[model samples]
Target: MVTDTDGYIHLVQYLTEHLGIFENSQQQATAEDTVMELFEAQLAAQILLVCGQNPSLTFAQRNLIIREVDSIVYDLEEIFASVSTDKATPEQTMFITEFSGLIKNLFDQEIAKLHLA
Candidate 1:
């Protein structure tokens, strides 16, 4: 979990530095959507890191990872639900798709690790 935490912090820093670029791009015009997309990406990266670290995780660590992933997914879903139709944009769809892909990749990796283990 220590490595996962370090990786998540690094990803947050990287995303923070690159957020301006992502926002300025034509893909995301509104600040709200941009912020949400950035958060989704950050969460996705954290999940990826956690999954990558799962192979060596103890039972307690596995439980922690599951809890963290569930929390992130729940929060993300709530945010998606709260987005008004007026604010709904193609960027949100793209962001969600990308985030989902990251999650799927993490799950796949974790499954592969389990098979190896």
Candidate 2:
């Protein structure tokens, strides 16, 4: 799961440096929600990456990918539940929820491809 973690870290850095995920949302977000969203985005991005790269992997690799991605997503969901107590600004909530949905959709699209693989 080193690569998975690295992908998450990379995503965090990319968001900080390029996309301004943190900066854009911080004003509207609770500290916890911002962090949670980062993890969510990382999980989604890695799922998409793994699904896209599935062809290079063996059956074992596919299973590993599924396990790792599922684990990360599960962990994020748990964290989200815990931090969800804080209320965000309406604008921030909208941004976070919509963006979260978009990432989820992206992940779903990629995961769907796994069946074909």
Candidate 3:
């Protein structure tokens, strides 16, 4: 099976190819890869949210996952602001805003799930 990072890298490559996020493929391993890491946390948060709903994990395990996800959320927010949209067209900007909002909502929903669990 592909590792999470690898899977995300491929997804990023696909997006970059079709979406024109960066100038070249060489950006894939450096800048674009970091963005992939940010989204990977979304997956982790979601999995933990589902896992936390089960009785299999002890309180300590659930808490650990929650803490880690909280840290990831912090990093995600930090990097989010570092990405520039200065050169984007109005339509591109709008699409990015919509996508970012969707991701933010998903992460927020995971936070709520953590609380409920």
- On TM-score, the candidate that comes out on top is 1
- Candidate 2 residue 40 C-alpha distance from true site, Å: 6.6
Q: Write the per-residue lDDT of candidate 2 for residues 1-117, one digit (tens) a residue.
A: 432444455543443353333333434654444455555655566556655755565677567666755775565466345443444445545445554454444444445565576
How well does each candidate superpose onto the true structure, as a TM-score? 0.39, 0.37, 0.33
How high is the CA lDDT of each candidate model?
0.51, 0.51, 0.45
- Lowest-lDDT window of 10 residues in candidate 3? 24-33
Estimate the TM-score for candidate 1: 0.39
List where candidate 2 sits over 4 angstroms from the true fold.
3-46, 83-117
Task: Report the C-alpha lDDT of model 3 over 19-112, residue by residue, as the tens digit.
Answer: 5542333323332334434355444645554565565656785675556545545544554445432234444434444444444444445446
Q: Which residue pairs clash in candidate 1?
A: none
Question: Clashing residue pairs, candidate 2?
Answer: none
What value does the lDDT take at residue 113 in candidate 2? 61
Q: Comparing 2 and 3 by TM-score, which wins?
A: 2
The local lDDT score (0 to 100) that residue 104 gets in candidate 2 is 47
Q: Estimate the TM-score for candidate 3.
A: 0.33
